[model samples]
Target: MTLWLCQLVTSLQSCLQNKIYDGKTLTCTQTFENPMCLTFSHHCFLPSWLFVKFDVSFIVHLWHVFLNVHIKQALNFSDTYVVHVNVFVSLQVIKVYNEDNTSRAVEVPTDITARDICQLFVLKNHCIDDHSWTLFEHLTHLSIERIIEDHESVMEVLSGWAMDTDSRLYFRKNYAKYEFFNKPLDFFPDHMVSISSETNGMMNHSQLIQTFLNSSTCPEIHGHLHAKEQGRKSWKKFYFVLRRSGLYFSNKGTSKEPRHLQFIAEFSDGDVYTLLSARKMHGAPTDYGFCVKSTKRGSPRDLKLLCADDEQTRTCWVTAMRLFKYGMQLYQNFIQPHQKQKTPMRSISENSLVAMDFSGHKSRVIENPSEALSVAVEEGLSWRVASHSLFLYVSFRLVPNEHHHGCPVCFAALHMAQPWFHSKLSRDEAHRLITQQGLIDGVFLLRDSQSNPNTFVLSLCHTQRIKHFQILPVDEEGELFYSLDDGHTRFADLIQLVEFYQLNRGVLPCKLKHHCARITL
Candidate 1:
């Protein structure tokens, strides 16, 4: 059956050649060694004849050429290119030593910080510091020493940067949640539902507090304070209340927000639990020093918890963030793309991944092959094709959109001359033209010959349709040229400019509406 099928197809090359655009039947004509057919049918029916009479070899060659063209279209030079985006920034905020505070943005790794971002804030009167105190102040919680010295009792408690003798023994006996009223914080989502009225329909804050407090031997409060203040303030108010109720209240204060309040509480509990257990046996005041202690089970390891339930404990922790060594390696790694996973290195890389190369016109295929997958990446580039005849080179450098900026295309065009295909406009000339005309760089208004404003089609060389063309300057140099769109300036810039003016003159007036100079990536 397969042999007959091959033979049948082999005789159809002649019919296929004559039926290149035929929308009728499955035209099978073999003109060369290649046995193929171009089928166009509305119904499920084979051709009337089983085979065609043509040079099968010639047909095969044509098929190969066609296949190659399709494959090239699929993976050759890019109609869409990659933009080299880079997000190198930093943040500048005034440092008030009043209290140790941990902010989400501050806690993030340094590479995620961009100099430009920092500068922006700095320009707006924010303090920008690039010193060791700033970096270390944010990364000390993950220290190995602290982790080793904690002695928590439950699974949740044990994991709180300490060793847990009771938890270790309890795990050996009972590992169920309900069996011990203990649950891991990791078990819950970052965002959780809450039903407590005191928390304004938020989760039970007191339960979270108790859980962390019980895990450690002592209660701690942490946060920042002015330079005049001292370290670690005891919650005298809560202490008296607990004392009157015959309960021990060790609250530590911290500058970390409510989210970290839990972690600090739990960590403090583990250490405090161990120390209190030991001190109780030794009949000591428990407040002898700021360190860890052992447990009743006689674990040789010294375990201590800093209770940061109050502002003081929180302050200490915040201070710790500042003390932490700037993890340059980890910070850089996180900010950059994971090369092994083929993820972008930086936000800029992901953003600038889309681009084009129109230096010449040989129908260049889309550049970035990965772009075929429709992912929510950054809008990398915007191409503005010239409509008439002038060809001008425009370049721009843009910050994020949140910075309140607009497009730079029209501003670059105002001073550019026409018949641009052969103009000799220089970068200085173009700059002078726009600056002298006092044209704002980014706004545009496209129009047609009827003297009415409208969008024009800018097409590629081989394109027969009048489609709006998009052009992005491929040159990286922060310079470009412009000339008259008419035949007078025939410079390179003039060629593109002329083409643009002849086709869409209406785009001129409103060019200054919200224009900004183009930012070259």
Candidate 2:
């Protein structure tokens, strides 16, 4: 206490002398020239003079009174002193880049990650609730960059940077990030989810998950689960194994035999969900418990609430159930996320795309294919310079055949139809198709709108997600040009714009590649 009090007032006299803080009083020696003699005022006596005359007890009593009145007023908030203290905070400014290259400053938390921050902006902007947004990490100093995986924290990525200030994170659409939820065929192979016709009719469900895991597969899924009693109130635990066929519990001890193992539930027409706050809400053993609820419009009592030992076990069981139920859709939802991030701005080189004019009427790639072959076959790829409507083309490499009957459209690339290089496509079907692919960046195609046939829409990928940008028709002095960036960028025709974006990087990561084409021999 003695030491603390001494240190407390160590700078009191000096601060009071210079008036650093308000409301404090000080007495100083009289100011004068060097030759002038000093004089003591009668009103303010020296400390020695006052102390020498008073008894020790009287001095202590006076000191107590002085501290009581003055200290309370000076220190207490209810008194005249309203102290405003400044706190120091170490903040790092992170610039968030939008689809249009516009940016906003995000006050990122120390524990923030790419996915968390993206969701923050999504909520703030009132964007769509699709879980396809992604964060792109760019190291300007090192001339290299990569996607910040959903599991990777932003701080962790920053820590690996060579230059702190120069490094940047790009947030944009990445449908592939969650495309598997829509495209199931690209993920689950035939043998993985199929019941073999040659094998015994009696299937061992344990071997189902093992086969999926062992294959050089489209998706990785496996985990442990607990099977509970059918009674909703009377709960009991039984260790179980989840497979594509259904949920099974080991009667003896982790038994794989059909006799020892018993079937519990199959998710063919159902879904599974993890129960939140199970300890309080459902009286579960652990809060990390889940249930496989049938979707057959049954009573809530029919649902089986199974509890896992921990979060990992619960998560594994739930994810595997979803895979078994939805199969390849989930895998397709998160496909080609790393390599297929296709923001319009991060696209191919700008000079590579070529624009053309479509005139005021409907455009066609080739009016007649047989006549074109005998006349000018290359005319089908014409760069129309019509004074009214416009056309464009992005560079595309035509592979003779892409994995058998599958076209690039099956994987979110360009769509081609003779006499109509680009046409209209339903948004749902487009989403279902793009997500089926790996969600490659710069994967784009042009199509007319169902509501407005006069104008067109450009569907493309950025950050592995598909975004539809409107292509508005503009008539400037008898000249027609289609624009997607609100006239910030324009093209003579839809084909020209498509061609331009393919070879050039115009708001897209790479040039156009895969296109649907038909040939007659």
Candidate 3:
């Protein structure tokens, strides 16, 4: 089947020679090996098709549509070449991060919406399409990134990217992403959604707009504060309230009447940052300090300085001020979590039970091609005892029964005891978990391989892809050596191997990033 398609493509390329345009002829000079074709029932007006080279699917979908139905009538074998070749559109290839962090550079039609690309992969990979997959446009250099909404175009998104090179489009899981839009309460915590005395000290979702609509009842964040006075050398503590009007402190207590209030400052058009030299600058409270400055582009000034009693208080005040300043976008970013489009593809369940095969590998499909399926089946039951002596066994230390403490092989695992590391997950589950927070390059985990029982597989997520490295053991001089690079670079044990890979990225895609941490206190 592949060969027949190859021959057909070659013939089509040879015949598609010249094009006549604007009375002057321009040769169809470029030889397209892997061309994409889109056809219209009537005729297309596309000048040409040009994009990154991708195999089979391009020709199957594009050529099949154009050649039989549309292009045959337009073909010209001789000069005067009166042709009306009407269909061809090629798409660019972008790397998509699969569930296990593995990357597949897939080509997609340039003109279609981002949702189309997700649907293509869902069908191609035979995944149960549940429609949660997404294409993330990351303009890393420009410091701008966002999930390409279902309605947006892939080419349009790429065109907006401003970078010399290093821009990327990520394909991964984002379940809670847009969930915030429908369920905003899940995204905004209680502290951030507080109601002040401005709304009679109580407000709900329905009342939120009504409360803020009237300037007189606008939400305000007020609390006790230690502030710097202009004329006074000594600092004094006062009851401070942040309202739409401005930051004000009561001359006496938490009194709202005009007589007892004094205006401190207003930060309608400025920004805030942590004051590193807080103690030296304005005698700010030690360690619990942050500063706000006016963003008057050219001119720089050491304006108003405020201090909080603790870091938490400082964070609350600064956050409230920011909510006050950039209300809409910031609030949207908070409530409307960046969600990816949903698919119909089957999602990997976290509770799916897995059992080991006879050879003691994670019992995945017979993946080690070197072992013949018939032979593996023949020796499947007794194969464990057969390779027992030669195979220096290494399994995941994250398993509950495995005592990681004081074991040299599990030094990294014991220290990096994250929840994701505690279980063996399939590629999709891994991708979903890693993307739950962010696709940090070095996020990684350890899982038992169903194909190889003598070794554990390291799943490292990097460059928006998951790379697998099999830990193999070699017995030399009565000592076991573990290696990922086909025994080229061997470590005394798994500990040394993990440590070496963390700092020096040898064969692995990227160095081991921080382990997934989950702490509840």
TM-score of each model, paired residue for residue:
0.15, 0.29, 0.36
* The best candidate in terms of lDDT: 3
State candidate 2's TM-score: 0.29
How far off is residue 63 in model 3, in Å? 24
> How far off is model 1, as Cα RMSD?
30.0
Sorted by lDDT, highest first, which candidate order results? 3, 2, 1
lDDT of 2 by residue, 1-521 (tens): 34323433443333324432242232213344532322211111113222222333443444434434443455453544322222122234577664335677755545555666766666666665455566776544323233455655577666644443476776765544443344333333333344335444344444443334433332323234444455555456665655657877777765667898777788765556546445765667775666765546334466677776754355445545665565544444355344345643433556564433344487445446565464453444452333222222232222356563222112222334322244656776565445333355555556667677566776665554567777787655444566767787886556667777767777655566543211110
Model 1 error, position 321 (Å) = 12
Instruction: Return the lDDT, model 3, position 62.
Output: 57
Flag regions of model 1 displaced more than 4 Å: 1-309, 317-521
Question: What Cα-based lDDT does every candidate model obtain?
Answer: 0.27, 0.50, 0.53
Candidate that beats the other on TM-score, 1 or 3, i.e. the better one:
3
The list of candidate 3 runs beyond 4 A from truth reads: 1-200, 203-217, 230-234, 280-282, 297-301, 335-337, 343-521
Model 1: per-residue Cα lDDT over 188-304, one tens digit each: 222321222443443443354332333232222222221101133331222211110111222344222333222212221223221222133332233221222322322332322
lDDT winner between candidates 2 and 3: 3
lDDT of 3 by residue, 97-184 (tens): 5433466776655566666676666656655544456767643332223455565567765664444556676666554334433433
